[model samples]
Target: MKKTLMILLATILVMLTGCGTENKSGGLEISKDVAFGEKDYEKIVSPANELGFKLLKEVEADENNNIFISPTSLFMALAMVYNGAEGETKEEIAQVLHSEGIDPEELNKANASMMSVLNKEADDIQLNIANSIWLNDKFTFQKDFAGSNKDYFNAEIAEIDIADSKSPEQINNWVKEATNDKIEKIVDSPLDANLVAVLINAIYFKGSWTNEFDKNETEDRPFQLLDGSFKDVPLMAMKEKFSYLENEKFQAITLPYGDGEMSMKVFLPKENSSLEEFKTLLTHENWTAWQKEFEVEKGTILLPKFQLEFEASLKGALKSLGMKSAFDENANFTKMINEDDQVSITNVKQKTFIDVGEKGTEAAAVTGIEMGITSAPINEPFRMEVNRPFFFTITDEETDTILFMGSISNPVQAK
Candidate 1:
């Protein structure tokens, strides 16, 4: 079996605004035709949560920096790639994804089912997911690999001249359109002539708060940073009933969005506990325990009106999470193409944007795994104030899948 050089790009945009509806622009659309058994649903959700925390830990190594990530976007792109992997390369990817025991075919079915569920339209919210494959016209890809993606992921197939100057634009345009123009470009530079194919996934989510925050209540307030310095930022205030929890270490609250189909959960560490310390306790076990701890309560909530944009190379993070062979020369991706060409990943990059204000939250993220590759809210009433750094996650309540998550150390800084 020969290694396949692969480059994957994934983007996610979550927009929180006032009640309104917008039509999505152009992209390849997939029909809801895939199905999965009950076991498949279990296979999908468990590993997704595990990967969520694992990736979170890797990215949060920088204690003082603000961090945001879309594990779903990254997983979907790689899951498509996993369909084309065999042997040790496949094993490594599986371990990293925490899908070690599950059969790859079964995993694909689970993902397809999950995607269908997530793409279901609701009147109050818009969650759109689009996928595509751009292949170099010169190379002949395996039919089975291509067909699986189309059938399972609803990925559109296109043949492009990789050497042409317009190639990157074609791929980035798909990204821009899928992300509602929030992310204009995923490829900042031209592709290498030797590059064969680029697999891309984009998810866009826009929804209004179940109870929109009153813009009139927003006021400039002092936000304490991790370093003891403070910056004056617009703090959006509200007094509403919410699912709330408080323990010795932190206080948490869940704010619903779009008829309670989705929510933002916020975790504010106690003044005595450092954010870093709280993060150590954020495992899957702890998260489930915390969820079980929530209760209905009424209290005042004060959150900052902040916006952030972040970009980073994720090669180190994925490698640290046991996806090492895919990046090394010894890697093998024989299932990608029938030819004997050896392929290894070259780079992986991610970019994300987020804005939180009186209306809601808007966030976007793009992950480019070149085989190059590889790849919240919260609330609180009970007088909870997000005056200091905290952790938050925006999730699909029905499926319990986390869409976007981050930690805010300073609202004014946008790195």
Candidate 2:
């Protein structure tokens, strides 16, 4: 759970084109250029970094050892909204999916069929909630097999039931299972299940620190928080060469994962800095420019070891970014999920948990189970000394997008 507060902020939806073959239906078709632009993806990742988190890595894969989100989460979340949406909002959704080269009609039909079974089974559940505020109706989805697995999060199903299904419970079960009994319930108050969205990313990552801090040399340290408070933190002190970056915006440090390929970068604002002001200046362009400054150099690195927890509704944040139409009850979503009944997207609730230690990293996230991978071996020693007040981030080795970001000011109360 501590890892989540620091890792939950990084994410990017990729643009995937020509995933598979041509369309069989006369409906809209997604093209080969359907992925989100690199710049846009980066835009989402940078802030998480500035906010004080670490992005480990992000990839698409399926396996038991890997993390998995029930396909029902995606299906159910969308269905709830579809049950409430109508006109222009719906059309816009369809257009986005269609422009991506997906068959809007086909996806809608599939969603409708699934909704029928779900609605019938949960007849006692009231679903009058409007979705125009969450999703547009016109949104279309790619229909090809390749299209199914092209997005950052997998939307297709391998084996599952839509109706007469007990997906809501499954979501809860997944939470317990992933957290090892630590997080017993991700969604409290079943009656308050206003909306749900689930996303799962499982990875086995190992990276060595640029400079290994001697465990015997570790000691207690102080970490500062945005509230002007400080706490005793375990500091891993080391002096070695590493990829470091310093600029007017912030002073940055990089801590490599178990393998030297991926690293976690920490950015510390100058003392007496306005945390809010520093955050506002964060952007994709600045991150790009700053990253280029990373170079190996010798210096004293003090990092604090701590765990933290935080929860907030992202609907408003996402809406401020131009995704409003999809949440309106009167929106058009015919291009996305088509059923004989009205449809739209309602709420988007996400819960994340993570644990990072000297051994490895484990994390779980849900977008809407009602809605919603792996690699590698390490032969070299990963050297990272995290023992002071600092911000960290994780990123894909190939794409610089921040996968997760957060701070370790007061490790004890972070959760």
Top of the candidates by TM-score: 1
- Write down the lDDT of every candidate, Cα atoms only: 0.75, 0.38
For 137-223, candidate 2 gives per-residue lDDT tens digits of 122222332233222222322221222135435544544433333334433333122221222321111223434567776788777
236-284 per-residue lDDT for model 1 (tens digits): 8899999999999999889888888888898999999988898789787
Task: Show where candidate 1 strays beyond 4 Å.
Answer: 1-6, 16-21, 25-35, 60-64, 188-191, 372-415
How does candidate 1 fare on TM-score? 0.83
What is the lDDT, from 0 to 100, of the residue 181 in candidate 2? 38
Question: TM-scores across all candidates?
Answer: 0.83, 0.50
TM-score of predicted structure 2: 0.50
